[model samples]
Target chain A: MRLKLLGLAAAVALLAACSSDQDAAGTGSVTGATSATAPTTNAGAVRPGTRQDFEVNVGDRVFFGFDQYDLSPEARSTLDRQAQWLNQYRAVTIQVEGHADERGTREYNLALGERRANAVKNYLVARGVDPNRVGVISYGKERPAVLGSNEAAWAQNRRGVTVVQ
Target chain B: MTMSAFMTRCDRLARLAVLALAVLVAGAAAARAELRVDITRGTVQPMPIAITDLLGQGQSEGQIGRDISAVVSADLERSGLFKPIDKRAFIQDLVSLQQQPRFADWQVLRAQALVSGTVEPQPDGLVRVAFRLWDVAAQQHLTGFAYRIEPKAWRRVAHKIADQIYERITGEKGYFDSRVVYIAESGPANQRVKRLAVMDQDGENNQFLTDGRSLVLTPRYSPTTEEITYLSFFNNRPRVYLFNLETGRQEVLGDFPGMTFAPRFSPDGNRVLMSMAANGNTEIYAMDLRTRRTQQLTNHPAIDTAPSFSDDGSRIVFESDRGGTQQLYVMGADGSDVKRITFGQGRYANPVWSPRGDLIAFTRLYQGRFYIGVIRPDGTGERLITEAYHVEGPTWAPNGRVLMYFKETPSSDGRSRRARLYSIDLTGQNEREVVTPMDASDPAWSPLIP
Candidate 1:
């Protein structure tokens, strides 16, 4: 009976600590709770919260090569560098988008782009990234990197891009 | 000698009795196969039309003007819709190729409609042809246009005239000025190499789009744009993707948990309607673009695929086998109010709604014969448009005046096959093969890519 009481007391203390820290964080405050315990990794919840901050903001662009969904060796290296950068900003998630050149039809391109984005996802997962930390979608041929009809433009258009989640 | 003849007669009678018994047994086992189908006769009257031969600057212009005009007249006449009046019967001189026509002279010729045109030569050696469609009954200008094309394009110019006349009378758009996209097949049948091909509706100006590393099928174009959506076995998973003509970009669609096929654009160009197969049954789904949302439209356990939306996107026409056999069904875009549209003797597949919203074209299979037919939305006026050994996948020309479908013919080698694209007017006339550099199928007609 004494040991059971001790365990309950420890749990209460931890909950109190987490509540107080959430209060301090301001944006993630929890109300109606006893507030006197230490905080854990409460920010790692899988559910979406404060989606406005997760909007695809500017300066967070991704790139790919012509008619290829499989990332290039250089692309993988660049993504590795980006992963390191992401590690420093510990609170952010991301979305990966795949695209294709406009020579083909529309639906096929959409499926192709999805494959390319998933390729990036596979690489990131293999590199020890959390699968839930990334989401993927395909824009197909709807969006283009460059707006020209020549080969140079098409080569640039086939790509997968990373955006801030 | 008399005894030998009697023995031979007895032997022949015994053999005849045994043959008769065998015939009776075979007849009893023969399959009794038949379906009572009510097929209504379509209108046999040819569409009234007029084609005026363009006069040239002088006799020095030679046979070019007459030849071009004659070819156009013949094409229209062969369509079975138009009855082109004889050029010699033209009451008016229309002598000046560059001037407007005297409608009164055409009226005197008893032409219900009048096609008058002029031919001239540009300084760059190109031919400039001008044509106009006049409605003697309505007493107004129907359609008029001018084209500056190479001398070799004269035949196409002729086709354009016929297309315009058909559209003006029918209140539908003309399809003669468009092109068809199909898979060109070559090499041995088992190891056939298929490539993406594009050609004019009249079998002119054929070009290969893809080199055929992967298999492609069922290409469909945006009703108003140059974009196309088709099923490609590129990675061998059978996914749907988009190919853009202008930017030459290809992008894959959603990463479905299962195989995706039979994709088409919503009339508004804002969403894609497709079928995703899971557990051996296919269901229809729609994806909205502006917001990344997917909606499952049909939850039936049957094979519900090949969904085509009406012009306004309010309803969709698709093929389903919910009736124990493959037949066409019409339902609301959200998958409510399912109504059977075809009650024919055979199975119907590949139902494509016309751009004009007045007709639906489909492929029907019956008793070892394949047919292409069109029916109105209410299931009235059902008409079988074409019959062949094997025909499938009917696509409409932009104007909905012509249908382009593929036919497969048996080769000397039973295992080998040849596929070719053929086009015909909605009136079921003027059937001609759209020649490709190689065997082709799964044709999709694009709107004039200006």
Candidate 2:
């Protein structure tokens, strides 16, 4: 029984490490990338600069209008860049997270967030990215990128973020 | 057997009142008039009632009697049907339970009804409470009863007495003997800590059932049992959990691979209806508790969630976005013959069918404001009852004559928000704020406890 408990603890630690690595690849790469020429080392290696390059050159998220699930022209352009990035990093699976402002009910906002996430997923799939490589989750208004309640803050919070896993 | 004993005592009191009235009429030439009130039309003008502080019988100046009497008065006053008179205006001080109140003194204060009671502390940590209701004008006792309860349950005894008096005067069922289970929230706007909490209807005996380690939402009580079903974000997965209040035991409803939310118990408390999201689509599902069998009630491609059963458990009213936006829809229990009910300008969500089965209460969003409204089951007679900056999650009282919902007021700095519970009558009047210790939301009213 003690051995089994140790095995479970090790498994949980591994999962925790993997999740933190994914977070580092998404948000921590901007400052952690040591060199710009690291992509020339190996052909199949996951280049350390891949995430930073995508975030700096191509956007990571796209904003939406109030209570709207349809993508704007700029949002489509961002999805085009995101599709190209995902195709280049073929081994990378990405999760598209949808969010909403704090204006609607909690349950309805969840549904609206799902709609927004799926809209982005469909746009990426239509642009030739593998559909199986993309997953979606709706955080609703629970996790907001901005903390204010005004129009400017709301416009920033109502967005869809694509994170590589 | 206890009920029959009380009824017999009531009979003897009525006979004694008749005899006393006959002697008084024979001695005085003036005709004796019986003060009576016709309460059939409802309480437009609240009747003035005076509730005396219950005297301690076996103990000297016990604090329990005073506390019980105060709670009883507050319960009746909050109902909007009765106004408790100021105790300072009482001309005669109640010293014992057996002493009759001077009717002329109560009449001088213009009180329509009077309540007097006594409390006796027992040796085994139990207390005996006896109370009598009197008509001030008629100089006769209307009702009397006694209860033996533990000292900890004295508030419940007070609420029971208030419920009885309310029923006798209003011709309707009383909601005072009820409790509310809701999410007690605190912390900043960005990260709010919500825990499951239960308290009496007047915000007494507040107790937290869950630690604030996980995110919990929409705690609803079973109509027939002391169990609650809510969504918990435990282990980074949102699932529906059933919590037994009596034993403090909790179990996950099912081993679903996806997220389940917006759980509500069926009117019979035998089934749980919730929304499950799979493959980027959300649908409504129901599971029977006895058989552990799951049934998909809605197969819509759009988000169909917040399913609530009607009073009879034959039909379900839920919110669906199938028609391009969020709206209210009604369907059969077997998920047949779906019909859209609301065609208003704003979005409608969280449609809870009234306990009386006549109307459905829902939260509406329009023009950047939230409103709590009710509509008939047939999609007609829509009325927005209360409007606020942010209002959602309408739960009905057991009697279906009132609704309780949460309202949030945004701060000027936008860093902190205050959320509180508010209740309003069915006719859109008597809007009052229910006080809580801290910020609170997602109030679910329990059925009157047996």
Candidate 3:
């Protein structure tokens, strides 16, 4: 019962905190539930009882090859599928992060990763998603999926990932 | 004409046997190496170096030998200082004699020096690497060394060979075997968790020096490998900390009641020159590491930071806004002879004198752009190496051939920020990333490990 009270308090805090006039486009609010069971809603307003089961999902990541910022056919297809889901849910705005492998220089890779993120954003917009619904950033090999010095790890590092803001 | 003159000189010396051997052997040691040849300057003409693949003789098809030598060649070539000759142009396959090299074929390629080596596997899990440097024009063996290490150390062995070549040709020690200290970062933009990390110069064997409990920056390695002086925010207070790399002990540098940042070792490593900021103003101060006594070098009410020492440790070049704009200034170690050295189109900061006492590398901000540039001590011959969105904080390699610095990527939300470290030749070729687990920045190169 005390845990339930704490959950309700958290929900109230989130709602009160999020209502401070900043959130305009009406992305769904994550409240009350733990980070694992944070509800993802299709509408901009807060929805009750929409909390999914508590399983922390490791989100899927997108990959790039070498110095190329243009997405491969496979990357576009994946983004198209993601766009379809995004279009179905107008409330969700994704933070698209671009990354590069540990091969090239840092600043150049930062620009390259930004171009890659822009490529994904351009694709999403072309697929009828709102440009405002997506935000782009470049990590520039600062974050790697794997820590080995082998090619396998490097391939995983050359990637972009989308996280819910 | 240059080649003919060199060749004619070689021919004349060849006729005099004893004179030829003495001059050739010593000249082999002191060849026409490029510019500063110290921890401050880089090569203008790519090092005229050549390395031939070691031809192995056995049923075992020499793949390991080829791979090892190739790794060595790649390491040297990536430095942008050496022009490793193409294997296809090799006139000789001297795998039969890695120790006693034949210098004629290498000379024909106009390669001033040649690196020939052999890799042999022992009954144990060790590999014996024997390499020799050949003075192509002088036609003499410069120096040879051999070592036995684990198979995984083949890459390090390659680096060692390149080090020997660099030292022999440049008449100075090589920094290829050294490590770089940097701030490894992670998480978000505003609340970044930074840990001190050390990695090989080639971006391998990276390990964290500090845990993520505190934020660290501007790690400067002492001349001795035991200690480092860097800025740390251990308990939310920013101060300079002296960390012992061996014992993992850390102590605050001085009892200063202000923030101390941009700490660097003196040339002799006895004192640390840093900028201590009190109120809104900052000044340069030197603190003796052995004694906790501090000496104030600058009495500026402006933002005077990023203090660096000259090779002789008698003077310091620092960045100050005393002239209403950020510019490089040189002053005596006793805070006398204050003379401005840079007055150009931009504002310059972080003026680091090359370890060789020739050039100073600095970060320049001009007209809404950031640049990494090098200039003579007199502020002439200023050359901008790279320009980026936000590049800052350059540290010299032990040999001063390359510089490592950090750059930040702009985020749309200003929340999802990223920063990472990079290294480039002074000539701006072979630019590459120094990989870390998370975001990294503020790289400082350590002295050669051995």
Top candidate when judged by TM-score against the true structure: 2
lDDT of 2 by residue, B1-450 (tens): 322322222221111111111111122212123333333332457789999888876544357678778988998887766789999888887783348788888888899888888888767666777777777876767665677665655677788789867765665677887879999998765466789998778887678989988878899989853789998877656789998776688889998877788999999989999998865688999999999889999997888999999999999999998997889999999899999999999799999999889999999999899999999999999999999889999999888888999999988878568899988878787778899998999999988865
lDDT of 1 at B418: 75
| Candidate 3 lDDT over residue span A19-92, tens digit each | 11122112221121211122344223333221111011322246677655567777777777667767776776
Fnat per candidate, as a fraction, reads 0.00, 0.38, 0.00
Write model 3 residue lDDT over B1-450, tens digit each, in one string.
322222222221111111111111344435344322342454356666678765544434266567667867877776666778887887765645554556776777878777776666667645566677776777667765676655555555667678877776656667776767788887643235779887777777677878877767778888765577897866645688998766578998888765677789998889999876543356889998788689999986665778899888988998877887678999998899989989897678778888878889998877656888899988789999988767887888877767888887756633254678888877776678777777888788877654
After superposing all C-alphas onto the true structure, candidate 2 shows an RMSD in angstroms of: 8.6
Model 2, runs deviating above 4 Å:
A1-58, A89-93, A125-135, B1-43, B58-61
Error of 2 at B214 (Å): 2.1
| Candidate 2 docking quality: incorrect, acceptable, medium or high | acceptable
What's model 1's lDDT at A65? 60
Q: Can you list each candidate's DockQ? A: 0.01, 0.28, 0.02
Candidate-wise lDDT, in order: 0.64, 0.77, 0.67
Please report, as a residue range, the 10-residue window in candidate 1 chain B with the lowest summed lDDT: B13-22
Candidate 3 lDDT at B326 equals: 73
Instruction: Judge candidate 1 at residue B178 and give its lDDT.
Output: 63
Candidate 3: CAPRI quality band: incorrect
lDDT by residue (B1-450, candidate 1, tens digit) is 322222232221111111011111122112211101111124445645567677666553335567667866765565555678877777666664235556677667666777777678778766667776666655555556676665655655666666766555654455665667777888654245677666666666676666777666677776545567877767645677887654556777788875688888887777888987643356888887567487998887566778899877999998876776678899998889999989989778878898778999998888767888999977888888898877878888776767889887865533346788888778786678877777888898876533
**Stronger candidate by TM-score (1 vs 2):** 2
| Lowest lDDT 10-residue stretch of candidate 3 chain A | A25-34
